[model samples]
Target: MKRVAILGGGPAGAFAAEQLASAGWQAVLFDEKLAWEKPCGGGLTYKAYSHYPFLLENSTPKRFVTETVLAAPRAGAVSLQLDQPLLIYSRFDLNRLLLDRAERAGAQIEQARVLEITRQGSRWRVLTNHGSADADFCIVATGARNPLREVGTQLTACDTMSALGYYVPGEQSMIDIQFLPRLEGYIWIFPRCSHLSVGICGKGEPAGALRKRLEQYMTEREIPWKHGSFYSHLLPSLHTASWRRNRVTGEGWLAVGDAAGLVDPITGEGLYYAIRSADLAVRALLSEVTGLAEKMNLYQRLLRRDFAGDLEFGSRLARRVFHGRFLWASVPARMVQFTRSSPRFSAIMRDLFAGRQSYLDLRQRLLKNLNGSLYEMWMSLGFRRLVPRKAA
Candidate 1:
């Protein structure tokens, strides 16, 4: 039996272990904390659940949010009714669920921290604090803070975003997304089953600045964030050049999830990419490719064909979407306004929220519908002018 060592127990590692073990491969997964919370929204889009039905059919405690409110610096807010609701889960719960699935699939789950990984000819020797293990292959899924420097994406300071937030003891029916001025990222309030994950993520900005912005927003909205638990983490937001040279696989090893920097630069969405990359990695390893080099190439090709190319394009657009000026206003402000005034634009936004829209064709879609959107906005303004004013 071929032994596969997975150096993480997050969604990506756990999912890979499940697939490999089920295929009769001996899979061993190692993680210091098998299940833990993260400073993220932990929301899964329609594309995720549609691709993996088990995500939707599971008995896990989750929140299905169908409404989202988008706010910008001067655009106020616009309520959008989602055609496909977002499935929100606590990271700890989600990780536990994936880990449980791997265990049930015959994977050996070890609660240990990986100290180092050494290459021993065609095999790998994984050194953990608890013990040592040998494997025919290695899968790196230790997230953005991967301790194994020899494997995974080489992330520089510019290739990451600081994500920090509070798990507030509150509840709401809708998700709130607030776009700030001059920031490369946005703030989000995602309501889980029991609490709200109110967080801020920004690139090229200090964590202290991000936290202050989040606190001010919370204070203005009276969210009482001081009473909530604070958490912060790094999110991979690879630049265009970084994507071109991203090292996902080499020798007898492959990296998945954040370790591979398979994250959406614009939306800060990683869960879908994490799971999707793991699936592709396992498929490539189990393929009929005769050589290790061929298998690694296959994995790279699979990722590019699946979503890496799209994410790379998204990296180019991230700055424009956040900081660019549109129609004499900030891009985010214009987006909210367009969503309110134009039905065509609103539909596009809905598709984006559901993950049905791809960044590769976003410009074409917007350009194709720009005329209709403008006409709708003009007509909406004219209709409002025609309506009689309410009596004081």
Candidate 2:
């Protein structure tokens, strides 16, 4: 059987190992912490479950969230419906489930830290705290704050967001997102089965400011948070430019998930991209269209094809919205009002958050609906502008 070595057994590595193992290939997964309590909210979008049905097979601690409340700066909160519910889980539970699935699929689990990797003749020599192993292929699935060496050397640096949050014991249902004025990120509350994952996140902002804002938000919302542990972490913010400059594969090795700069720069969502990248990487290797080197090259092509368009659009949209730019007929405040007043507008947002719509499709739909909304307003009530157009 062809052997593969996977470093950092997070969702990316674990999912890839499961796939390879199911296909009768030898897969070895190494991770120091197989079940980790990742600090941020652990919520997967709709298309995630749609793509991988097996994610819901286990009775792990999780919750299905349907409603969401969005609060723009200096605006009233707008409650919207998630037609396709979002699923939230504790990272420890989620990672444990991923590890269990991988092991059950015949992949060997190594609970050791990877120290270094060297390229030998037609093979990779991976050094671990326990020992070393040689494999035909290697995958680096280590996340944003990993200590692994330059496994994917060609990979460049991207902006990493400082994420700080708390898991408070509470009974809440709706997911809340509050946009900070002029900040490139937002604060959120993702409700789990028993507790709420609450936090603030931003790109290109002060760490102290993020905490101060989080505390202010908790106080204004009257959220008593003396119950759960507070934690802080880093999240990768790779949007269009970063995507264009980075390559996930080289020679006999490939990078997946955060290591590959696959996370959404805007939403800070990487679950879908992580699993998707690993799946495509395995397919590219298994194809062996030419040789291992050529197959790996194909992996890069596949990632670009699958990820580029949406990422570019997301990056542009984030700049416009978060930086307070106007979108033809709307700024952030006007856009929130549009969502509050128009069911059609709300549906588009629902799809965007639920991962059901691509950025390209969302842009097209919003533009088309803008004209219709204008016409509707003119015919009914002499054209009231929900979103005011800024003077150029």
Best by lDDT: 1
How many residue pairs clash per model? 0, 0
Model 2 Cα lDDT, one tens digit per residue, 99-209: 899999999999999998888988889899999998988888987775765665243344577889888878788999888887888999988877888998888887788
Which digits, one per residue and each the tens of the lDDT, describe model 1 over residues 1-392?
A: 28999999998999999999999999999999999885678999999999988899999999999999999989999999999999999999999999999999999999999999999988889999988999999999999999889999999998999999999999999999999988999999999999899999999999999999999999999997989999999999999999999999988899999999999999999999999999999999999989989999999999999999999999999999999998899999999999999999999999999999999999999999999999999898788899957879
* Candidate 1 regions with alpha-carbon error over 4 angstroms: 388-392
Using all chains and alpha carbons, the TM-scores for the candidates as numbered come to 0.99, 0.92
117 in model 2: Cα distance from truth in Å? 0.8
